[model samples]
Target chain A: MRIKAIQWALSAAVLAMSASAFSAPPTPAMLSNACAGCHGTHGESAGPSMPALAGQSKISIVESMKGFKSGERPSTVMGRLSKGYSDAEFEAMGEFFSRQKPFTTSQTLDRAKVAKGAELHEKNCARCHVENGKEIKDNSPVMAGQWVKYLEIQMADYHSGKRKMFDRKAERMKPLSQSDLDAIAHFYASVK
Target chain B: MTIDRRSFLKMTAGAGAAGVLYGCASTGPSGSTADVMPKTGRRVVVVGGGYGGTIAAKYIRMMDKNIEVVLVERNDHFVSCPFSNLYIGGLMKDLSPLTIRYDKLAANHGIKLLQAEVTGVDAASRTVVTSKGTLKYDHLVLSPGIDFRTEEVKGYDIATTPEVIPHAWKAGPQTVLLRKQLEAMPDGGNVVLSIPLAPFRCPPGPYERTSMIAMFLKQHKPKSKIIVLDANPDIVSKKGLFLKGWKKHYEGIVDYRPAKKVTEVDARSKTVLVEGLEDVRGAVVNLIPPQRAGQIAVAAGLVGADKNWCPVNPTTFESTIHKGIHVIGDACVAGAMPKSGYSANSEAKACATNIVNMMNGREIVDFSGINTCYSFLSAKEAVEVTGVYKVDKEKNTIIAVPGTVGVSPDLSELEAIYAESWLKNILIEMST
Candidate 1:
């Protein structure tokens, strides 16, 4: 009788542990997967045009999704995606993405382009992005390893007024020359 | 510091005679000099010299001169939240313009100002213990302000902060540090600014900072963009104005986002992970985590067990938790009221009046509240919305009265000049 009672107790403990783990769900991993297209493998984006999403607060993230869905927080790409998720799902998505690991980009560029980009980047970009593009970390997108094509698209968009987003910085970027834009994008892509 | 018996008696006689004469003079003309003159020898101790504390201290002197006021602040100087964005944008040369000096408070206003951190408060004892000394009070007012609660963020501490990313909420070194970081970043470098959960000091502050940084980037680094990872779904204040500014100014340059929270920080690899997205990497990261009441608030048993802010009577700004200890500013759970300087100023005035009535054995009247939050779209143009509020018995929170608030749509040249002037006037009103 004692042996049977002990077996039952052990079985109950195992079941309880497994049940709790299962109920928690893998929300962060799921959100991370969905975010990879624009935000890159980690939280790094293709260029300065794409935003970093590594370490934002859960409340801001959830609210932003609701805004995009409701058309309060305006976005060309996110507004559509935001419509697909409910409040609970948005919350879960924010929670999940907020927890995922921040990854460095994999893109690289030639040294000559980097040298030229470095000078221009220092003149205009360093004021907010941090010196050497290495300081002031978290939530801000990493320019390293992002696709050159994606960077080019964003720059052209800013120049041609395709993506009209909120920020004085973006408006300032709209008037750059093609070579200057390419050089800076390549420089950032080579940060890693 | 003790006065002799003879001098005390003489002073008492003079005070009594003056009081009698003043009372008799009240029968004369209305708004007479005697009627407006301050009653003498009343000393008031004001804790926390932020928006609330500064306004209370300055107003006390402005209203009357007889009462002696003492202001205790942890920091030597205060950086204004209103125009800090300009500093980040590189459109301005120095942040010193945003800082208000308290030297004039003592010299011009005759306020006894002390720079010290309050460590403990004894409600029964009616004494406040600071690093310098214990202070007795006729009525005590506290506005200890805010501090971040980092427990929510994994693998992070104060030292690691401002090293990778700077949360320049409190100003001072952090503000300068953040500016330095931005100045050094390459043109196309990745810059991340993490927005913390709601109920933090300055609700629109993080977004404003983001805009300023974007302004800097737009001019110099066309290839660089800002990724805003916010914990809220939408923008809170002057939403339309910010959107308009972003669209017209930033255009395709900004990758704006909301409703995403950043849960962790990987310092070694310089990566930030959003729950549903791939790892976001940054050449630079500004991780703004969650926040709670400052340490002094919690230490005084002002905060609840849930670790949220303390509760207060909306009309009086007195602590619901402890009697004789009023918790003002960002430390209280005043619902629907975003933590801003303007709100704190209004709350402080109401709190001061209530304290005066309590001391004088007069009936305290309940008052309506007011708030105005102005956001400068740039150095030149600004937008604002004002609201008037009263306590709702049904909801137990401050509710807006209908038709009390309206946004400032037209940014006329005259309004722009007024906005700039208002910054200086308000700063003086709070500090002097």
Candidate 2:
């Protein structure tokens, strides 16, 4: 009985040591499987309603997910998806998407307004969206060459009752004038 | 900052090893090995591992070596309710530091830590049935924490906890869930947070959480804003401090809408429709709905028909309804004292001391002590209030013993550092 007890204690100690060791983060495949449901395959996102996730900064994506899980950010969709995922999974997902080539922003604008829109876009949006409105692969949205109609609709929907999104980072567009909106749309859509 | 393996072990093992080493080495040879042995070995079962149950279990073993304490908690870890707001802001990362492993209790303090949920408490037979096994106890201390009355809000239930707005009042999966929702949302999305009326656990919790969310939006989602729909007319504790932080740090960053009660939540449409206000289209919604004691309290026929909380004797914390069962934490009608971790910890100490005194053939102390609640405003800054309460003879309520309280000075860089240090030290004391 005494020898058995000593062996059991030794096993417990070994288990504790092993838990501390080999704590390397979860692999990218594990993260891809975890995030593929909501974020879609290759992190492209399935629909317009779900924000596109092809090229988001790894730090921003991890932090945002952490926020939702911890009550810093509150959403049902992200909340449900974030649960059961370890912190290492968050890092892996962020790194995987950050390395992928960014999707080309779709082209949709008239040539007449592109010049005026360029000036406005450079002044207002360049602080967050750098690299010719393409966002350097993974920071903000790829405003360049995105659908003009979608951009116009989203800007107008900010103050209106039809659309309600809550990423506080994007609230700067809330007070944009119609002319300011038109100029930004034309400039971004002209990219690529 | 990359942490090496050696440093990490030192930081993590500092508390647990220090406690046991002190227990055996500090005292004389008589107090060393002799004191380490269990004297009573009497089975004392604790349900929750929050402020009350965790402190009670630790202190009970400290006072008498013989008492065998078995703490059955559902979660594998314990998260501090005090500084949870700081977590909302990007100030503190990795909630693992804020949480403590249960292994420390069993390893250092000789307490049996069971990671299982207790389903029923057989008071008559004196057996607590958990998912694992039947635990027989001589004295039972229940501090299972509060449970939200989800039925009060329309279209909201336990399933909504992870899917829609996560009411992360209870930590773990819910906390992780809320964080993910925040990440997937567009920058200009509408975030709606509802604050229920007074008498809930942690009165200032809702405001602090809202403030942190606002701070996050200001920096990252600059165009996004938060709408606070509060049921109460005025803010509860630390209203001035939280208001100052909001106006100074997050001014023009978010909107503060008060006195709007959330009537129903449409999980399907992702909307929370409040009474006497506009229908809120929230990309992420945090419905901090109504709350009541845990299911065990109601099952044991402890709570009154008033449907508010269970009543207990002010002197002993013994349940008014049940004889053997003792109610502490948020479940009981603890007068005047706010339902906070500090108050619960203080009450647990008093109850444990009294129980021990009775068993050892001594008198129990009836005097009241201090009850302090510290709430973090920003990651660094904290505002705290302490109340020295005494039971009123004629009124039969716990009244604040006049002029026996103190508040921290106004916000400063120094104050923030102090709050951070206090949070770390307190978590260590509570968990280990």
In order, what is each prediction's RMSD in angstroms?
A: 24.3, 21.9
Candidate 2 lDDT over B206-273, as tens digits, reads: 88788788877887788888888888887876777778888878887556677777877887777777
> Mind giving the per-residue lDDT tens digits that candidate 1 earns over A14-69?
33332222222223433333343334323434333345555434665777677666
The prediction achieving the highest lDDT against the true structure is: 2
Model 2, DockQ value?
Answer: 0.01
True contacts kept of each: 0.00, 0.00
Docking class of 2: incorrect
Each candidate's lDDT (Cα)?
A: 0.63, 0.64
Q: What is the interface RMSD of each candidate, in Å?
A: 24.5, 22.6
lDDT of 1 by residue, B136-204 (tens): 555567887888887676666678755766777776667777777777888888688888767788776
- State in Å the error of residue A47, model 1: 42
Q: What would the TM-scores of all predictions be? A: 0.61, 0.61
